[model samples]
Target: MDVKRISGLGRNAAGDLAKGVRQVGPGGQVIVVRPANSNFTLQEYQNFVNNFKPQQPGVTFRVVDEAALPK
Candidate 1:
């Protein structure tokens, strides 16, 4: 399956999510990676989904929470 990987949390994570949706379209899956204590809000993540358009039937988003990733 074609997958879009988003690394980081909060604003950074959302940015990646937006990029994924834009580049991969609504037919692919999105993977968001984030730190444990980035103090990010769920709304940030939802914001990405809200802006995503042309929803495809098989489209999906997967978030990976991983801290200590190199910036």
Candidate 2:
């Protein structure tokens, strides 16, 4: 499985992400890593999930907190 690291999320980015996910087919995994202090709001997060969910119903999505990562 090829891993892709995206800097952040936006309309175009999300679209591209969805497209990539579709290309990967089902069982694909998408791990989103947030910054140490992220400014993304709850609604935005929900929207992000909503956007990708329909595109790839079988894909797995995970959010990783950067601060929680071992330095």
Candidate 3:
């Protein structure tokens, strides 16, 4: 299965960023790593993940929130 990439930006902005893994596959794992915010909520995260779609069914899609690397 081809791997998909989702980029989560903005620190402490999970509301706008959306905080959860999207389209996770059976074997793949979605990794979220926003700037550890004390006020990050789960609902917003859910919204983020919900907006994503798997390119193909049973493809085992996964997400990863990484530290915004320097440009």
Candidate 4:
């Protein structure tokens, strides 16, 4: 499976999400990497989903905490 990895979503989370959707298209997986104490919030994450759902249906989106990942 192809994964579209996005790291460090500071102020441009939405834009990055759009890019990911475009890159992966439909039926693709998106892995978002953010810090445990990141500025990104769940509301924003949901907004990304709500905005892109119509354009890219059946896309899987997952957010991963960089600080929690095992090395």
Each candidate structure's count of clashing pairs? 0, 0, 2, 0
Candidate with maximal TM-score = 4
Instruction: List lDDT for all candidates, in order.
Output: 0.54, 0.61, 0.38, 0.61
Pairs that clash in candidate 1? none
| Reference-based lDDT, residue 2, model 1 | 37
Candidate rank order under lDDT: 4, 2, 1, 3
Q: Mind sharing the TM-score for model 2?
A: 0.58
lDDT digits (tens) for residues 1-55 of candidate 2:
3234444578765765676677677877766555655577434554675566536
Give the top-scoring candidate (lDDT). 4
Candidate 3 local lDDT, 1-71, one digit each (tens): 22323334334333322222234434444444434342444444445555644343443323333334343
TM-score of 1: 0.45
Worst 10 residues of 4 by lDDT: 1-10
lDDT of 4 by residue, 1-71 (tens): 23334444444666677677778889877776655565666556545545554257777777655676888
Give TM per candidate.
0.45, 0.58, 0.33, 0.60
**Span of 10 residues, lowest total lDDT, candidate 2:** 1-10
Candidate 2 residue 66 Cα shift, in angstroms, is 0.8
* CA error at residue 57 for candidate 3, angstroms: 2.7
Model 2: lDDT equals: 0.61
Q: 1-71 in candidate 1: lDDT tens per residue?
A: 33444433446555556666666665777765544565654455445555554344556776545553555
RMSD of each: 5.3, 3.2, 8.5, 3.5
Cα deviation at 52, candidate 1, in Å, is 6.8
